[model samples]
Target: MHKPVLTIFYQFNPWYSTIGGIQTLINTFIKYAPNEFEVRLVGTGSDRTQKVGKWQEAELAGREISFFPLFTLENDNFRSLIPTTLKYAAALVGHSFASDFMHFHRLEPSLAALNWQGEKTLFIHNDIQTQIKAAGDKNAILWRRFPAAYFALESLLVRQFSQVFSCNTDSAQLYRQRYPSMGDRVKYIKNSFDNEIFYPLSRTEREAQRHELAKRLGLSEETRFILFAGRLHPQKDPILLVRAIAALNEPHTHLLIAGDGELAADIRTEIAQLGLSNRVTMLGALPIEDLAQLHRISNVFVLSSAYEGLPLVVLEALASGTPVVTTRCGETPKLLATDNGVVCEVRSPECLADSLQQIILHPENYPSTSCVRAAQPYAARTVMRDVYSGMFTRWEKRTLSIAS
Candidate 1:
């Protein structure tokens, strides 16, 4: 019998990740894991109180996952993540000593499993300091003292892990650029999505759903709804989106802004000041299920954030067969390459509006389903198959060498 494997993740926006790309990877792992290995997953939920108990668990076909949400959003304090991480690490080490491998998504939580010392792999979600640096442009003070701890996972930290899995080549290149000594250790792992949930709906269904949503939202059939489905914050450039929408010369083009954030009020003010109160709809913070429905109803999907780590929203939109336009954030190169989505200049509404106008009018020509299906291979099942096959080959070689 083989020892189990433990997968760890950082779930800052827990609700979003649960329904996003990483969720697809986790769920896929559950669906098609090999019998030789048992897998346990751990995540830090938004609320630390949501940690796993006996009654709370995730049931996959092959294995039952005992999950504990270590730290919650409300409970983030000084070293809270550190101590809570240690507690979970202790639990995994003490009771689940059979775990032979620990795969991590973010830097901090992986530190908790530092002592497990088995085969360790860190997935580069993004360069946190780069994001903070970009965000600092708008809110100078909050990030003025950006913590030194999270600045860059340089040589020392990179060497600590046995392997590194980056979301894209750019992310890996950044790491290699920062820590050339460990350049050979980092690898690329594309995010995945399930085609079943994300594929294009039938024309009839889409038309019907759009009609009903239009009626509910007081939109007419002639109204063209351009969408921005993300947090309304300085980091996302909601004002840029507003300015872009205001610049559109196309008639009947409306902007449906779904999601809420610290900058919601400010973005709303900007919209009003631009005289787009009627043209722009602010559908604040929505459920993931509803967000998908909105995508199905949308003419085009647009993301204008200043930073990202392979944002799953673009994938989700592409999966829904909705034409998309995004900025060259963290992993935009890979995303645009595979999905054929448009890349626009970040924080520039003029560029965004032009892209949006092009996507909306000629959206039918775009291969939306191709974009959705492009994510299938990176699903958990596919990744596990590759990992296990490679591991088995390596193990056999080591055993053969020993026998000789």
Candidate 2:
């Protein structure tokens, strides 16, 4: 039997080179995809040295996948997105002709493929309107000033796709209610974590990893770490996390941030102002292996985001047997159980601090086994199998319709 060719597109570099939920999701899907399907990736190449429109080959888990990189200015600024959006859309239009199916990770790329005649699938990473409202002025000028325009655009573009996947259940339901006609096409798909890399370590093994991490960071092994791994942006509310850490007022408790973004300087300033400079450490962006180690050793993983989809880091933390204390956003309220973690109010440092303190003070309440068990349903292989099966089902239906 001939394999179907699937082209996946996003407006960022390949997952291996970047760190984010969308990148990780695309990479995991490709990694665990059925052996019978051929996959190709299209993304932006910000490296000025690499020429755009050139095809490159990358190996993931012994499988060679084709990658086409487009030229675009990569930055957090709103103005920068215009060129990136145009470039990704143009590339999708060109690649759609040869692809058996086109899969888009986020709205921009999916909207760009509106003109494509082939089977198209979109993965909505977050509730866009909610994200905009939560972000307030921190969002782009256009989105912040006129959110209705963006909402209308999203409503228009979403209807054009054959299949739509939302990582958050709440967001999925919201979409279903908003677009009753396409409710069946909009499915809720959980973001997954690699069990092999993220599973919990034995007590002794975890201690060893903790010691190694402490030594590398020049901290004492006795220091209790609270890990925060995500972009340091307004939407993620890293500053709120810093304020929460200050409110925590636990001398032994230290904060370890593993990602970098435009708000790095602002976070540093907050740390200094709060006299948490000594207690807070920024490790910048880390490799997945390093992040997994951090997860295994940390007392608790925390996120103070204004909004989210189903954040992969939270799932990975649970898989590593590390409980999480995150704000109520995305799928967290439904995903987190009393035995696994706590959910705090969004943008409230006091609430965040209280929740973190509860988890830190009574770790036994949130058993490691319970945390790991909660993550089993979202195992990368299992989720990816379901995603691929769904896609093939849709493809089969389209084939039969064409034949008839």
Candidate 3:
């Protein structure tokens, strides 16, 4: 039997191993996609010297995946993205004809494909309207200023997809409410973590690793590490994390940030102004292995996001047996219901400080086993198998109907 070709689309350089949550999810799909299907990825690559449209094939985890770049640009500025959007739309139109099924990560890149009548699936990574609102004036995106109009446009784009997958339960519920006619087409699919890479270390292993990390970072062996691993964007509120750490004020408690984005300079400034330069370490965009190691060594993980769609880092932290103290965003409350972590109010440094302090001071309340158990449901293999099975079943049914 011939295998179906699944073409996945997202607006970023596919060559980059990790970008953010959406990219991580896309990589997971590529890695764990059903063996019976052939996978192709389409995205924008950044390189001024390279041609706009090019195709390349690469093997990932023993699977041969094809990649096609929609366009190449000098930088990811607003001006360059205008042409990139047009190129992406045109590329999608051409690729849609060849694909047995299409999957899109974000709505913006698919807006121009609205008229394309094809079997397309959409993954909602965040509730855009709510995210924009939460970001308020801090977000520089043009759509943030005209939220209602943007949402209307977004709704129209959503109608193009046959099915929508939301990583956050709350976002899925909101989508269902917004598009009641779609019914069961909108699904709440939780993001997952790699159990093999992110599992908790034994007490001896963890202590030794912490000692090594402390020695490397020029901290005392007794230092308690607070981790925040995500893009340093306005939505993530990295500056607020700095403020929270400043408020935390314990000499032995240090913050380890393991990602970078546009707000990196601002976060550094905040740390300097608050006199936390020595206490906060910025480890920019680490590979998965290093990130998981950070999680293992850290005493607690923290997220101060204004909004999210079930952050993968949170799952990774939980899987690594690190207690979390995060803002009330996405499905964190549900994730923390098992007493694995604490969820605090959004955009409140004082609240974040208090929560982090609580977890640090009373570590016994959140057991490592409890944290690991809470992450069991989001194991990569189980979640991906179920997701792909459901999708392929639906596609097969549609194919049979068409033949008849």
- Model 1 regions lying over 4 Å from their true place: 11-36, 44-57, 60-63, 71-98, 135-153, 337-340, 369-384, 387-404
The TM-scores, one per candidate, come to 0.78, 0.92, 0.92
Candidate 3 global TM-score: 0.92
For each candidate, what is the lDDT? 0.64, 0.80, 0.79
lDDT of 3 by residue, 1-404 (tens): 46777888876664554448777777788889988888988777676543456777767656798877676643332333244445566666654434678888767768656666557888887877577777444444556767888788777787777789888887888888999988788988878887878999987899899999999989999899999988777777888889988888576899998887677887888888998989999988788778889999899999888888889989999999999988888788777963688888656778889999888888888889999999999999999899788777877887788889
Clashing pairs in 3: none
> In angstroms, how far off is 88's CA in candidate 1?
10
lDDT of 2: 0.80
lDDT of 2 by residue, 35-91 (tens): 778888777677766567888787776677887776654652223444456556666
For model 3 the local lDDT of residue 384 reads 89
Q: How well is each residue in 308-364 modelled by candidate 1, as lDDT tens digits?
A: 777667766777777777877878545564334677864577788888877777766
Model 1 residue 300 distance off true place after TM-score fit, in angstroms: 1.2
